[model samples]
Target: MKRLALILTLLSAPAVAQDAGLAARDAAEALEAASILLDTAEDSRDRVAALTDTVRAFEDGLAAMRDGLRDAAIRETELTRKLAAQDAEVAQLLGALSALGSRAEPQTLLHPQGPLGTARSGMLVAAVTPGLAAKAAALRSDLEEVTALRELQQSAAKTLEDGLAGVQRARTDLSQAIADRTDLPKRFTEDPIRTQILISATETLNGFASGLSQITENEVAEVMPPIEDRKGILQLPVRGVIIRQAGQADAAGVTRPGIVMATRPSALVTTPTAATIRYNGPLLDYGLVSILEPQGDLLFVLAGLDAVFGEIGDVLPAGSPVGLMGGDGGDIVSLTSEGGGAGRSETLYIEVREGGTPVDPLTWFTTE
Candidate 1:
């Protein structure tokens, strides 16, 4: 009976730990890949894109590490509780084994029921001894795993620190590369006088959008490939979750003719399709904004950015980084947060205008 209890003590661990172990290994591999990316970023022909990739790699790795750590914490807590609960039974098993070994010779072994009982007791002990050894081996493995998990958590702190630093460096490099970039095609140079006059005259977004063509430096009418066929399938300019639909009011009871998306701080904001930059600066109530014209008479308005990329007249290809969301993005405490990026999110406001009329952005981009 004691032997059975001993085996039970070592056998109740859930299969959850195996998943955590796999996650930890995968996180380590991802971190290694990010490190390699950082090392090779400087040599890439397109430093902006390379650095962006590096930063994304680091973010993915850190997120995985956070998940693994959370799982390890939960598993360790369960193990501690289980082992503590079985302490009394384990002690009883040890006591019984001790009594069986106290007698040096088999002939000297005695039972209250005389020789027959003694023989039966010896036979039972012999039958169960190998099973006890196997259970003891399993208990040792569990204890070792617990120790390893603790060590992994401690070591991950440094990895988290390095990942944070590496990603920041990559982001900085990307920003600099964008600033120094000058190879993009120009649809039309922006005239400052026209832009300021238009802003001063317009009272609303619709009015401002209507006057976009008037700000052109030289109105030769540059023709570009049409994206009318790409409607309802365009990717979002940034990776985010839609928080508010078009015309939805906020806590302040103010509503706008645009959709709001919540995204992680410092996340890269890209153009969903090939577009010409009609404007890229602060406008009226909107913070920093990027106005893109994907086709004639159609405009995409992106607002609330910390940094803007590309010049006013530059025509950008698809997936080009337009700017970055606002935030420090270096929250060390969130390194072990289960879902990762526990920091507050920055919001991006997006609006689609067709022939100067505001329409639901979901008409072009799906939330999924």
Candidate 2:
């Protein structure tokens, strides 16, 4: 009886040990599952944050574009009123000229005199004719200005329409990008304190450029494709005619090395190559400028934009939308050669630099 009791106790002990082993295995699996869930939650949170930032950026860009459109509309209305006034003035001038022509014969008859008087009258006519010619020339110049202004107004309207469409497209793309949640590798995170300091400290282009140069000194170099091999093969950032090429003197006699393109108002600007944006904002006389670096020692500067998109340090693929030209106001006097036609035109200045030396962009882009 004692032996049977001892055997029963051993059997119960083995059963109890087996149960403990099973419980330990279950706890280990549960802990691993919990850890996995925690990791997944953290990943999801990071993704959500990235998506939010992207959406916010898109919203800001859309707002800027809309603001530009509104400003253009206001400019258009003002130009229309000025054009109407100019038309009335031109008509009044024409009427006055007609009256003068009609009275010429009578005035000559009423002044009955001899050969000496006739010679005096001829001299008077010569002086008066020159004055009339000057007035006519002035009228023609005014008419040309009116025509050009009207063309700009029309182009602004077209640009507004195109901008609306572009905004909608960008919205859709932003939504899609968020949904996809693509995990793009980060190049470098911006130091908020440093960026703020740079923003507040730099007032001029040279100052801002100096700050950027300093910032880049500490950045890890990124591998990029060779840009030197693509000379004359790159597409123009904006579609237009090269009205002014590098080294050409502008009306101001400022012979800065760059290409000035006469583009349709509100024309969309695009990236010419895969590049990282270094600077994007108003600088000096260049209305909104964007600086892109495609590879080592190569920088592309695009100026005269109305609105710019993408933040500094953003890596963009080739042909990505960069910004839009605000086609509202123009230096009509400077644009006489190009804007004298029926179409409205805006100017864009592009410059390429290698190792701080300006290079002709015509050699890199397909201007035709």
Candidate 3:
């Protein structure tokens, strides 16, 4: 009986993969949402924001589809390897079962030891047969699962391609919508000549930041709600991974009082809280930048963008798109690369200042 029980090892392995189909279903739902949004895009009050949501949905759907396919491939390979590894044990079980099953009960009952031996043999065969049936059923289940996973991978390829195309279209529409937006209220107008003079005279970021108000045409301050109360609980301006914290030295051994983040190419940048745009334009070596004031003397400076949205002095709502990270919209390249890793290829630098002094941004924003 013990020897026969060992035969079950040829089929014994708990399901190693979860329902990969669930991920594919989630992807389908997200893609559907994107499609609906695109169809009704022109009716949207804030087309820029609406299109941003659509693009994000497509991105999520593509990621989910890719993950589902990857998981299915992995599971199928594991099952195949397991089956190959236990081939010898499977043959052993089959041979042993054939001998036991080929015998007739009546012939066995006519044993040399008479009725007692015959009855014992009969009992042994009956006891082993049911257990064998259960194991055979489990083995069949695993084989079926492998087949299903293989078929899923094939179908998901089309879904993934559609998601990619949809997201690209949304991105293009979002760019156009942003270009047409002109309804935001302005706190104050900017003076280009004064800003140029300030930039030319300043030797460092601190000097330039300290004199930000000099470029403004209006001295009258707009009274906004208190943001100090929301300190230490603000969201990040962009979705990314923090590569460097405040005061961290880089490869050049130069330290900066800011947070450096790595993000996917062309990722949307947004405001963590409702704030007025203090400045928005190219400055110094920073590609393009936007300076925001969320409170009385607090400034949030975001640098290294491919494009900047909204004019200087425009008051933006929380989560408003400020700009896009520099990239040509290849978000899935890293996902399919040799490393099989995720993407975070663009760099964004964020600096927070209070009362003309630099502070740790992590203290004000929560990160994953």
| lDDT (CA) per prediction | 0.76, 0.58, 0.76
Query: After aligning candidate 1 to the native by TM-score, how far in Å is the CA of 63 from where it should be?
Result: 3.1
Alpha-carbon deviation at 293 in model 3, angstroms: 1.7
Higher-ranked by TM-score: 2 or 3: 3
- Alpha-carbon error at 294 in model 2, in Å? 0.7
**TM-scores of all models?**
0.78, 0.47, 0.78
**Candidate 1, which ten residues in sequence have the lowest lDDT sum?**
1-10
Give the clash count for each candidate.
0, 0, 0
As a TM-score, model 1 comes out at: 0.78
Give the distance in Å from residue 77's predicted Cα in candidate 3 to where it truly belongs: 4.2
Q: TM-score ranking from best to worst?
A: 1, 3, 2
| Model 1 C-alpha lDDT per residue in residues 297-323, reported as the tens digit of each score | 889999999989998888888888899
Better of 1 and 2 by TM-score: 1
The global Cα lDDT (0 to 1) of model 2 is 0.58
Model 3 ranges off by over 4 Å: 1-18, 60-70, 90-135, 200-203, 249-254, 329-341
How far in Å is the alpha carbon of 112 misplaced in model 3?
11
Model 3, span 227-261: residue lDDT tens: 88788999898866788889999999989999899
For every candidate in turn, the CA RMSD to the true structure comes to 7.3, 30.0, 7.9
